[model samples]
Target chain A: MINSEHTAIMLIAVPLLGAFTTAVFGRVSSSLRNIWVLAILASTELLAVLLGVNVLEKGINVYALGASFPTLTSPEGFPVRIILEVDAMNALISLIACTITLIVVVYCLGFMRESRVLDKAYTLILLLLTGMLGLTLTGDLFNLFVFFEVVSISSAALIAFYVHRGQSLEAAFKYMVISATGALILLFAVAIIYSQYNLLSMAALAASIKYTFLDEVALVLLISAFLLKAGSVPAHMWKPDAYGEAPAPVAVMLLTSALVSLYVLFRITYTVFNPVTPTIGWTLALLGVLSIFLGVSMALIQTKLNRLIAYSAIAEIGFILLGVGSSLTQSPHTSKVGFNALSGGLFHILNDVLDLGLLFLAAGAIYYLTRENNMNRLGGLGKTHPVLGVFFLIGLLAVSGLPPFNGFASKLMIYESVYFFNPLFAIIGILGSILMAAVYVKAFYSVFLGVFPPQELGQIPKSMLAAMGVLALLILVIGLYPATVIKYLITPAADALINPGDYIGGVL
Target chain B: MALKWRYQRMLANIAYITVVVLIGLGLYAIVFKQNLIKIVMGVHIMGSGVNLFLISLGYREGGVAPIYTLAPKLEMVLPTPQALTLTSIVINLAVVALMLSFVMFIYCRYNSIDSQDRRLRG
Candidate 1:
């Protein structure tokens, strides 16, 4: 029988090994390299799922490194080495990261077939997966910072893959600057926490935190750095630039990367600073409102297709943040309300990944066919590529939070729960969703419904269609079974977040 | 307090002030500088300042190195921060290399390192 502990280690190790082997052997035969990558990713995703199920079934899974026999606590009864602590919350997110990465890897086969730097792209993708897996799985604070750097550097390289395009390199530089700065600040926060408690383990820090001035400084630093990484309003300039300039497959990967940052943001706010500080929670809400307002409003004015979707993505993040922010009110009456808000927020993470992922794939298909990203130049794709049009329609409806779609289920929860907090905020949230719908509808009209362009569009690749088809199918299934998903996946993850005692106990 | 002891306290304060000043300079450069290389340098300076602060956290008066071979029984400085600073310094190296390569790419593409002339401007 395969131990679940081994699954945790394999989830990260396999990808790192595969990345290196692919880079070395990829030069000999591209097809062989592609198959190798697919197989590696397939196993990684399976193991991630297995790990998630294990965590869900048996509570938190702690795999201690360099121990006598891989136990949680040392002989002296204190955790001293690095550990992989997989609770329901991280396990679900780790599964989401792997699942989305697998889909994008499949898409990349067709998307980057003709590009000369295929080996580098594949290698970077695998390394990117390694970084993300490590980021979500590691129990040590310093290890998290290290893995965070891995994600940022690999992603920055992937964003600038098309070096010939002047703007892409420009985008890459901006992304690197922002990420590097955020990472250093994050490291400084880690240092601060380390200095205070003389420990690097997250659970230990959480247990020992005194909420001192230094702790507050660390908290502010962490919130600001993660908020910036997740591309909230004040620091969101990098998102549209990076997402719009990256290749479609890479853009999808970047979306997941940004989601990891969001995951960390919630993890820190909830676990490290649990019982949700009223001020911090409200501060997060304020940022969420701005992101929603700016993202949807700016998306309305964008003429470019990718940039528009990117802006809409920012707005979607706002919704998730809103749900998360609502959970910060800690009164006894509001605790029930906070749980509901957190569940909605958690569910929205999955919904956003699927919906935005589908839309990006549709956008990629359109770009793949026409080599055009400007809505001004794209016209009548509905006639030439009906499959893409259908896919785009599903994405459009789902993202705008219409009923019978997964987005609607979560957003409705968000809308109701947030309403308990403030009626005006709920009203504004509804307005943002409405504006988001208009933005996507406008994009649909401009690109897919207009008069047929005289220029001929290329046929979409089968592999790309297969990728989109799978995403579209998942969206439909989740949309159909929202309650089942909520009961099984969303609630456990929320429980894990609200109660970090299990996480700390499992580690120490 | 004795004058010499007061001087020693001021000296210790100077060390902290220097770290703070270096961090301030780094942030100033990162936020206000236009040159890409200068921005990269700002990141470097900030990183160094933080690393310095980390090393300072491990300092002990008249303590020997925390090496087992040299001082198995002696009072030694806190070694964890030194270890952390080592890891951080390596990470900083990787970041600096990546940032510099990106600057090279930027120069090749736009022939300018001025952030204003870049196409990604808001």
Candidate 2:
């Protein structure tokens, strides 16, 4: 039987091999290349489902990379050789990442029906997925960084793939400049940690972060860099232009990457800086509140759909940050409030990816139907394309934290948890939810609910619907049984977050 | 504190400030400039200045180059920052080169290099 950890890893390697071959063969024929991309992504989805089944069964399974055995005394046990560590924490998240990636890949094919140079696009997509997978599974810090670079570069290249628009060039240039700066800052922090303790594994590094001024400075610097990567307010100016100008699927991919990076940031704060007495927690919480207000206020005024989504994403990030911040700062004596907030934050990450993935796909679909993504020019597409309208509705409802959806459940947890922290922030958080809902309603009314567009654009292909439908289904399932998933996946991940000693014990 | 060390600390801190001022001026030029290439050069100058600042994080009272000799000692300069500087340099080079390539692509499309003015008017 395939265990939890390497099952996901095996899933990763197959696509990596496919990506390399596709890159080699991508020059051969565009039609043949499309098949290769679809087949690989389809196979990747299969592996993710199989791996999820195993993770559900085993609770939290940690498998060594390149070797079958697991021993505490072994160097691999310390995450020395880039171990693929998967637990219930990452199992659900992994499935969502793979599922979204596959959907995006398929949607791209239909979206690029006119293009002949589509094979390079397919190769880049698979490579990006591999890097995202490696980033999710890697138990080592430097290894994670390497994978992050791989994903960042591939996605950045994907942004400029069309090369037809000056806006894309401007977006890509600003993206590279800002991203490179962040990457350098991250490397500097990693070196500081590695130099202090001759180990670069996340688990090991956390174990080694004793209370020292050096550690404090390093932690602050890392937080700054990661917030930049996470696309928080003060550091998030590039996100709107970058995401807006990129192809819609690429925009969705970048959103997932942003969530993934934030997940890493949460893991870092909980594990590396856990020992400090709650000051870091308050500081982080403040950052979250600031981002929430800024993002929402900005989103309200955006005339373009992509810019709206980008800003709203920044607002949602505030919610995640709030949950994490409250959990960190909570009195060690109170378990329920802290645990709920932390788990809620992690849950929202999964919810955000799928729901947002569908929405971006919908945006792409809308653009494909009508040449413009501007809300001003678009209206009443609902009658012409019923399926796209429903997909957009489900996505909009879920992200707005409406009832009977995954976003609602996670935001409930965040609200309840925040009630215990501060009433003002809780109110602000709800206000943010309302603002997002309002803006998206404006988005929905303008695009899907109004007057019909010109007939020249034709329908968005059925392949695109397949992708959106799958993401919608994921949101429904997670929404329906929040407790079961919370008990199984979120609990274990949050457990590891709170008692990071467990992760340290597992590795070192 | 030793007398020789006091003089060195004063001199070194002064050097840091001077370079930092030049970096600020260069960045000011980059932000306010209308030319694309000059802005890129300004960014490079600012980047190098930051790289220098990062290296200075490892500075100490009486430290030498980080290479280890046969006889082990703890008095050597902090090798960590040096390693950080090396990685930072490679990453910076990659970033700058990619930026230039994008500029070239932009030049081809627009038939001009005055990015700010063109972006504004377009």
Of all true interface contacts, what fraction is found in model 1? Answer: 0.73
lDDT of 2 at A95: 72
Candidate 1 residues A1-508, lDDT tens each?
4677688888999999999999777878888898999999999988998998899889988887777443446443545477888899889899999999899988888887788898889899999999999989888888888898899999999999988887898888889889888988898898888878888878877787788898889988988888778898889999999999999889889888888888898888888766546888887877888899999999999988889989988998999988888786662234777889989989999999999999998898888888889999888889888889999999999999997888999999999999998787788999999988999999999898879978866777788889999999988999999999999899999998888888888866
lDDT of 2 by residue, B1-122 (tens): 69899888878697478656757865675667766666667667666765676677667768767565563564666664566567656756766776788889888988887856355110
The regions of model 2 sitting more than 4 angstroms off are: A1-12, A46-84, A331-334, A454-457, B1-3, B7-92, B111-115, B118-122
C-alpha RMSD over true interface residues, each candidate: 1.2, 4.0
**Candidate 1 chain A weakest lDDT stretch, 10 residues:** A68-77
Instruction: Report RMSD (Å) for each prediction in the order shown.
Output: 1.8, 4.3
lDDT of 1 by residue, B1-122 (tens): 69999899889877577779888989999999999999999999998998888888889878899776655666689877888899889988988898899899888878988988866654
Candidate 1, residue A155: Cα displacement in angstroms equals 0.6
Instruction: Please list the residue runs of candidate 1 whose C-alpha ends up more than 4 Å from where it truly belongs after superposition.
Output: A69-79, A331-334, B1-6, B70-72
The docking quality of candidate 1, as DockQ, is 0.76
Error of 1 at B99 (Å): 1.3
C-alpha RMSD (angstroms) for model 1: 1.8
On the 0 to 100 scale, the lDDT of residue A341 in model 1 is 90
